[model samples]
Target chain A: MAQVVAVTMTVNGVKSTHHPEPRTLLVHYLREKLGLTGTHVGCDTSQCGSCTVHVDGMAIKSCTMFAVQAEGANVTTIEGMGEIGHLHALQTGFWEEHGLQCGFCTPGMIMSSADLLSHNPNPSESEIRHALEGNFCRCTGYHNIVKAVQNAAHSMAQSAMAQAADD
Target chain B: MYTSEFTYHKASSVSDALAQLASNPDAKLLAGGHSLIPTMKLRLASPSALIDVSSLPELRGIRTEGDTIIIGAMTTHRELEFSKVPLLSEVARLIGDPMVRNKGTIGGALAHADPSADYPAAILALNAKIKIQSSSGARVVTADEFFQGMFTTALAPGEMLVEIHVPASVKGAAYEKFAHPASRYAVAGVAVVVHSDGSLRAAVTGAGDHAMRLTKLESEGVSSACKGLVSASDLMGDHFASAEYRAHLVDVMASKALARAK
Candidate 1:
């Protein structure tokens, strides 16, 4: 066994640090160390997207990466997107469009979708399907998930236009 | 299977990385970790040190230099998805879902040399070249010469793959594959490239121990009609898929790809 090393990173707009074994996965660091339980660990394997998070503005499976690998990188978990008082548009859209069930995959699903919409505001059904292909939702057959992305696309586009009008 | 406690070193430059590799021969170079980390977690591989090369600035980005498109080894699949090179970008987008693409890199995939990987087929079809560097010097190896066998490559110990070079002569290309349900790896994948001079080349992966060029199919001759060069159904064999099933997919995909290319 090797000594645990200390690493520091920016998580969802906050600076945090931890001392973990070199093998400590980023997901474990987030869930156990930081106590941000919003990121679930359904499968420690990379096959499941349950532990997905944004590393340096790109969505990636946290289980596939190590805590030291994220040293000095910016990370965003589900909690960073919204809270009880205010919800991000994608969160609201998922709820309104019924994009989840059982909800084991919702955090990852929402995180991946939010990342997609950030680059492509109005993605087509095919694009949405392609974007979410990495994420698996056993409960919802993804029909409503697609609809949620569509709805969020419209919502995001409308908001952009409104902001432009206000400006 | 956590990585056994090991020292982590971030290399600031190519020379520095090479020096580190030379000094600590047991250290594993960490790229995207899409391939290495999983094995580490399973306790299949445990190195005494992990040299983190993921942040090496020199090993990132994609650009065209003269007649060749030079893609840095560390360029992420997400970066490749948006590359101005349309064919490369499309191939990148088709790789294992978004999260995988977000972190996996072309050089890392090639270096890992997984038989089922998507890029090997494309690289073979494009007739690309791989650049490798060690403490001694650098050399370029053609795609066909680089891959050895299943999870095997021509890379020497302490050598690192640095870049991939695709020629500009390739006018258009397409990659079509039947992905395995679970791992998303190709059951049998084919990539076809047409050159500006009307020449055609084909490469297949997941159909054998390593991605191979379909020389037998390419040499058979293409039609002058500029369409319907070969039927996808004719390309199947007994390796990654049944001979009959692969033949059917090959003919369909190849014909469709030919039609679209025209």
Candidate 2:
């Protein structure tokens, strides 16, 4: 059997370290080791984005990456987006617009959306669809999810403008 | 599903990686892990050791030198999708979803040599060259020469692809694919590169085990006029796709891509 090794990295703005089996997946590392279970795993194959996370400011399917591969990288899961009091624009849009049903894919969808907006603050509808193509939601039929992204874009733009005006 | 137990060695530099590879001949280089991890979980590949080359600084980023654009092997699909180079960025955006793009690397994809992959066609159309390094030294191979057949490449044992170089003279390049519903890989994809003189070159993926250039047709002086082009149906007779269907798609997609370029 292979031996486990210690891995160090930054997660959710916190420096962290852990020992994991060489075969341990990044999804398992986040959900089990780091106690951040918001990321879901719908399909073990990389086809499903349920295990999506941001590694070094880019969206990636954590299930397809080994935990040790994330060593020294900055990772952000759904848990890092917001908390009880403050909601990220994506969370607010989804909550208000009924973007989810089964909720199994919410965290991944939200995480992917955040990654998209972080790169392109204003994306067209087709671009939004293209961005979310990797993420699959079986319950909501994607109508509300698209609406949620559009709404979030507007909210984010307004907030950005407000901050710009203050400055 | 879970992966089998295996030793992991993270090499900080290219020399260290070469030493690890030389010591463990059965070791596989680990980059994005998008393709390798899934195969491991499925028990299709059970290497004794994994040489982690993801952190090799020399194997990341995109820059231009002289007449060629050099893209480090470890550059992720996300980086490519957001690249300032229009052709590279468009090709990157055509890959699977954002998550897949984030972790999948150009080197990993080329090494895997999945014929249905979009990048192969793009690289083939752009006439890119792949560079490989090992303990012995480094060697360069063209994209067409690198890919041998289905799931096969020209890489020798212990050799790792380090960079891909594309000539800057290429202009008016575009990629289009009919993605499979589940995997998002191209069922039949075509990438077309047109020179300023209207000379055209095309590469097709998802039609065979390895991406192939339509040299027979190109040599026949297939013009940008989009008239009398070969159909996907005529190009089939291979394992992955039928000749007639692929021929028809070739006509449709090639014309569409050409039109889009205009």
Candidate 3:
């Protein structure tokens, strides 16, 4: 076994501390050590965005980085997106729009979509497609996935407007 | 897939990173780890250690010194994509995707010097100056002299790329690439820049073993004479694109970028 290193990061909202081999990837660390299985590993290669997670609020492929590299960073995994009772807008969008079929790519799709919405609250159809170029959805064929993002954008905007009205 | 086990050291500063590099002769300077990590995972490169300079404040932002734009080594592709830099923003936007851009740094890309990487095309065309730091001293080199060969650079031992200095006066620049559908690696990327002197500069990437000056286009003035400037013998052929096909692409992309370069 390689030398184990102490890794500390704030995942979702809780600070996590673990000891793993320095070679362990962030995706594996999240799944194996932290037990956050929501972030899938569709392809071990970096090409697949299935392990997408927000590192310091910016989406990145988890498999491309090591666990220790994320030390002192704030990470947001799929499990952190929302609870079962209180789902995120994209989570609801995926469910309502049937954005997934086999569901292998759902976590990554939702994570990447949320990343897009965070930056550009209102993205065009082409913009949505462009943003999702890193993630692969073999089962969904991307139609429902695109619709899900569009739906989320609409709902998120509506809620923002509602909050503004309250303000 | 996991990278081979290696010692990790996070450097506190550029000098500290250089000291680490000096001590660990086989250590690799880790920036975004977008390219190096992937390569390491495949066991193509198994460095003994990784000196993490990703968080060093000395290598972290974009600033302007008179007419030169100084881009730090740790500036991520995402920053470049949204930055007001002319040809560089266009080139950076076409690299990988949003997620990859969010972590991959410009300095890492240039230092890695992947033959098919996008930034070299723009860097060469813009005549950018690369700032390199080492235990010996710090020195600046133009983009042309910096890229030595495939996966090779002008940096000597214990040296690392620290910043890129680009002229702020570049105008009417454009980058056109036929990116690989799956990997997004450039199949043939051409960057065109219209110099203030009314002259034109162009560089080619992906089609060859390294990014190189499209001297014919520069000499021919970004005109129709750029046709057949690419020689098939100088390019690499894969299943996706043949050397001859890539040669054709260089010509077509150069002209397309030229049409937009004004």
Candidate 4:
């Protein structure tokens, strides 16, 4: 019923090529084809941030984009982030700050927070709240989520300073 | 959510996109895919083919040519948020969210003309112009004439919106909106612009079937107890908001926008 199209994109620092239907969402391409399931789909609609991922270094809802549209993009999923032993700062923050009652929205929260930190390294508490507006955490309120982001920002700043001192 | 299958054509150039449109006739031009893709997923729109114009260099970036600020069709909302382009940047900051802003383009917002979309109010108030291109040639239309009724625009069958031109000297401008909490779409939004000669232009969105100018507010200024902030006849009323409530919002939002305009 659909014509298959060849799409090639860099995923999590790995080059992958796949033939998919023109209508296949990038989220599906990641989950079904690449077997990367960290990015959840709380809502297939664009309203939920669970499917958020970095495309060419910018956070976008993967479900809103077609795999074919990502023709030559460099996408960074949660899998591309730090591994189990060495988690990204946001991931570490979530663990330490009790950020999740249920872990469904954790990947999107981390991905979106990473984008915010990339632009505004030391965001104020309100800025962190505004940045996480797209991401919804129903099981737990945003109190812990905000704390988690602040915790990550604080640690990341400390690490940067330590690295500068080492240099 | 699986969208209906359609042939995808990644256009290499503006002309290439136009040729694809000319050949397919029913093809929809895809820029950013923020608005169009969601619609396709919902089965609200199912075009047989999509000509991807998101990557065309000819339809990207922002520039200033003399007294006018020219914005390419593919300029994403995130770029405009930091562009410092007067009212546009202020309005762009409030659209959808960070992720949606990253992939949503100004041209896509204008072309889709969802009635509740934010930019129509800002563009109309700023007296911006829309540049449209077809296989025939390119033509510019004033923002006032660009948007038609209810999810419609002046764009023709084979044409695509290419650029937007706004006066560089919009000294005083501001936008205020009562947004839907989850989606951040405007429930009642107002944009006000003060021209160099001190003339006023204001427009309203989300309260009506299509965005329209607040001629009374512009003529009398916000200091006045501007009677009839919006026409009762032209408003949209759903379970979320009543026509009476939206009228009240126009007054409240207009005052807020006017106060912020400097």
**What lDDT does each candidate get?**
0.83, 0.84, 0.92, 0.91
Alpha-carbon shift of residue A124 in model 2 (angstroms): 1.9
DockQ of each: 0.78, 0.84, 0.88, 0.88
Runs in model 1 deviating more than 4 A are B224-244, B247-252
* Higher-ranked by DockQ: 1 or 4: 4
Model 3 chain A weakest lDDT span, ten residues long: A40-49
* TM-score of every prediction relative to native: 0.93, 0.93, 0.98, 0.98
Candidate 1 colliding pairs: B231-B251, B232-B250, B232-B251, B232-B252, B233-B247, B233-B248, B233-B251, B236-B246, B236-B247
Model 2 C-alpha lDDT per residue in residues B117-172, reported as the tens digit of each score? 88888888788899999999999999889989888998999888999998666658
**Worst lDDT window (10 residues) for model 4 chain A?**
A39-48
Each prediction's Cα RMSD? 3.0, 2.4, 1.0, 1.0
Error of 4 at B176 (Å): 0.5
Share of native interface contacts present in candidate 4? 0.89
Clashing pairs in model 3, backbone N/Cα/C closer than 3 A: none
> Which tens-of-lDDT digit does each residue in A28-97 have in candidate 4?
9999999999998879888879999999999999999999988899999999989989999999999999
Error of 4 at B133 (Å): 0.5
TM-score of 3: 0.98
